[model samples]
Target: MKQFPFFIILLFISSCQYFEKQIPSEKELLQKELKSINWKEVDEFPSVVDCEKVNDKKLRQQCFFEVMAQLIQEKLDIDTLSILYPELDTIEVKVTIFPNSSMKFEPQFSKDSVAYDTIKIDSILQARLVDFPKVNPAIKRGVPVKTQLILPIIIKAKEEKK
Candidate 1:
């Protein structure tokens, strides 16, 4: 029958749309992927040779921080920061680790810290914080990323004179 053929043709044409894939544009796909990603956290924290062996993610991160703090403490111990500011027992250092595995360190001082000579302290830190161990940059979705952290460094030990 003619009506039967026409109905089949209409059904076939309509069904073709169901099979047709609506391929997304690259930009749309990229935006969708970006939205799904958690920007606040990294897949992997930055690491040094000593921390690479740790299996647990949290432990590895802790190891990296500890190693970094120890290294910084050792480097600054040789400086005369303690003598310059005997009252200053601790200083916060803002460390920025780059994707290229380079690092920068800056002293973080409070706004009310007008009594301390910030410029002199900054210069001393710059002069002292150098020659770090090889550091691997942080990873996010398999890509290396830059990370910033604030580390509290003890400048002077409390002297208990008996």
Candidate 2:
């Protein structure tokens, strides 16, 4: 009986180690992808006046990446809504750019209250509005410049039910 318990413990440990070996760490994956991209810094975007200053170039790059990720997420949400509600009529999606390079995605259904869905996307969108005639040129030192584009998603139903 004692042997049986020991054997079970051994099996569990071995299984865990096997699974751990199979799953790659996030850092490893990110490094691999980063290597593939020919990264180019964006300088055309106007400096963000409100955000706290970043000290290093790497930090700035990371910040821009975060913003881009958020923007992509918002786009995905819009695409998902369109797919999910093909019959939906007059779907209005509100997209806003926050000061900290974030996006708020809110889907408001004017016709049906049940269809309303609010989604907040943060830290994933790069600054859309760049202040020209920059207040702080130093803030733009290493920041990747990106244009902010907002697309209000409105999906209308083809036919209304009487």
Candidate 3:
């Protein structure tokens, strides 16, 4: 009968570890969670000055794209877009917005693969890009991240009669 009491005590002591709290500290916990987060996707995408005001997630994304397109078009100086010839219906300007807010400009034709004035286009784009403002980078757990943006500029010579 005495052995029953000792055996119960032994069992209780052996299982005591299971009841102990193993909770990590706040910093440790955050570090652990950060490690598991997928770097490919972010909580918030990169945004410009105007797009930052939007509250909705999906709407913010759309605003970001729209604002970027508008800004690029404005910077292109459509008034003098056709210095060589003013007969073309539209001029396609492809620009890449880097994470650091730097731009890569590629002016090319949509259908016809013709040689372009790379130097002039690069200079114009460089000046415009420098004049433009930097954008807020994408965020993953509040950390800023790099992103890519492509903008296409099309110039129409005249409106078609409808």
Pick the TM-score winner. 1
Ranked by TM-score from best down, the candidates are 1, 3, 2
Write the residue-wise lDDT of candidate 2 on 80-129 in tens digits: 34445565433343444433444444444344455434232212122322
Candidate 2 at 26: error in angstroms? Answer: 55
Please, what are the lDDT tens digits per residue for candidate 3 over residues 1-162? 989999999999999999997888999999998899897787998777888778998999888877776776666554454554455434455555455656565655544434555566556656765466777777777766666555565543433213
Write down the worst ten-residue block by lDDT for model 3.
153-162
Backbone collisions counted per model: 0, 8, 1
Q: Write model 1 residue lDDT over 70-111, tens digit each, in one string.
A: 999888888888877898888999999999999999999999
lDDT (0 to 1) per candidate = 0.91, 0.43, 0.66
TM-score of each: 0.89, 0.25, 0.61
Candidate 3 Cα outliers beyond 4 Å, as residue runs: 9-35, 79-114, 158-162
lDDT of 2: 0.43
Q: Order candidates by lDDT, high to low.
A: 1, 3, 2
Worst 10 residues of 2 by lDDT: 120-129
Q: Cα lDDT of model 3 overall?
A: 0.66
